[model samples]
Target: MPSRFTDEREITGVADLTPVQRDQLRAAGKLYDGEDLDAAARLVDDPDDERSFLGFCNLWRVVDGSEDRYDAWLYQVDSGTIFRAGTTDVAAEIIQFGLETRDPAVRAELGPALVEAGLLPKSDVSYPEFAGLLRTQQGA
Candidate 1:
């Protein structure tokens, strides 16, 4: 699948970020890197900003690459600092990420959002079933 994060800017180091952006990553116990920089640029860009949705962006980036990266974003999500819901983009990203990873844990995390958005039926389906339903919804 093509990357949803399409802007391919090179981020050299933490020095390129604003102090607040640096602080947010630090507080989340995450280091600044190319992917983190990309996620930050796409998700959070201001100082002292508290947008929880960045967690999802980071999660989407790392889900298929590195477990440690995935864990860092998962921690950010569990930290409850970023709030994501009621938006088509957010819901869609979650669904796409879940489908791409095919990880039950990721699917379980996103399942409720899919159901709440009326994209999936409100039933107790297994992870694979839930993924299949999403795939069908996407016309895959």
Candidate 2:
């Protein structure tokens, strides 16, 4: 079947994934309009089958063309679901909530794991101190 990720090579695909799964793929630039969702689903499920999750969730500042990418990646994604999804990545999607969101409440709620994961510096994990450039600059 044709690939949904790009105008590229063909591969066998899996179907019957959830709407959110499809949304995640779409947000990450894995699937496009009138493309193959099944093939896109295959990329996330198969860890050893040579897959690359494209697109940057952090580019919500500059790239405005992709509403799905912007909304789903930067805001709608949940970090707890990352491990449950096996290989699919929501880390890029949800980092803003934990480390860079302007809401101190959100950072307080989600920043701990980011800090423990080494995504945040030890110094920045403190309340007055902040983790990312966006976090410090925009959040403050």
Candidate 3:
């Protein structure tokens, strides 16, 4: 069975967005308001709202042509704990980004999954270093 994250329809750009989806993306952007991921997550009052928020965050690159901003959004989502409850595609994307950016937080959150996915080896030394950083942050 296809996962909920698996959208068969391809949305190429802003022009391809539906009116409601566009509105949701705009609302989500407002909630994001200058790099605040917690604020965006707070706007999600329910599952439907969460889905809309994540969808916008995930596809913002297509609309704005900003991969770095999208990576920031993914990092924020993971930091906000939304990524823990996100779909497979969300996890996979974040893991991929983590590997690319060497983001300790993302590595800490998805280390095991990364190994399982073969993106990182089980013996990866960086996992311990990143996990230690995560522990320090949690303890702080």
TM-score on alpha carbons, each prediction:
0.25, 0.31, 0.25
Give the per-residue lDDT digits (tens) of candidate 2, residues 1-140.
11011111122232543565555555444322234344364345444533323221211111112312111222123221121132344433243333445555444433443442344445443533434433543344
Q: What C-alpha lDDT values do all the predictions have? A: 0.34, 0.34, 0.35
Candidate 3 residue lDDT tens string, 4-116: 11122323245555554444444444433433333334335465553334333343221112212121233233321112221211222333234433455444444433333
Global local distance difference test of model 2:
0.34
lDDT of 1 by residue, 9-95 (tens): 233345565554344444433322223433344455554555323433332222222221122222332221111221111211222
Worst 10 residues of 1 by lDDT: 80-89
- lDDT score at residue 116, model 2, on the 0-100 scale: 29
Q: lDDT winner among the candidates? A: 3
Candidate 2 weakest ten by summed lDDT: 1-10
Backbone clash tally (model 3): 0
Backbone clashes per model, in order? 1, 0, 0
Go through the candidates in order and give the C-alpha RMSD of each one to the true structure.
13.1, 14.3, 14.2
> Model 1: clashing residue pairs?
52-82
